[model samples]
Target: MAHSQTEEESDKMGQFDWFGSIGATPEAVRVLNDQPILFTILLIVLVAIILQCVLLWYIHYATLKPEQKVKKEKKKPAKK
Candidate 1:
């Protein structure tokens, strides 16, 4: 069956087309439709920042020494 021009164009949409559908703001949708590569790079940088923060936290926690318990002296019963 022959597809309409609009249908053919829609079929050629990039993988990021779904981003324009899920409650994105009009401006965001415009960017996604017009500059998909910029949107993809922005997402990559955002994810990299989040991952770097997580890795730094993991390293900070992993190298920490456990606290040593302090022994308290027991007081003798009161003298008669």
Candidate 2:
């Protein structure tokens, strides 16, 4: 006689499908192998740094400069 499906098998399938007929192909392993994690992280960090530097420069240049201060001349009153 055939046995009914076990709860463990159903639970495992619910969590992760080892034999699911329909699912997206796993890409993490291939992506990791194709591009080294360290290099990818470093590249992202470098891009962030460059973008930050460019942003800082853009903000620094975009700010309005202080207006030229006008000096007023004071006239001395004639002494009696």
lDDT of each: 0.76, 0.57
- CA displacement after TM-score superposition, residue 68 of candidate 1 (Å): 7.3
Worst 10 residues of 1 by lDDT: 62-71
Model 1 / residue 14 / CA error / Å: 7.3
Q: Clash totals for all models, in order?
A: 0, 0
Which digits, one per residue and each the tens of the lDDT, describe model 2 over residues 1-80?
Answer: 65555654344332223313355243433344445675579789999999999999888766847553345779999899
Query: Which one is best on lDDT?
Result: 1
Clashing pairs in 2: none
lDDT of 2: 0.57
Total clashes in model 2, counting residue pairs 3 or more apart in sequence or in different chains: 0
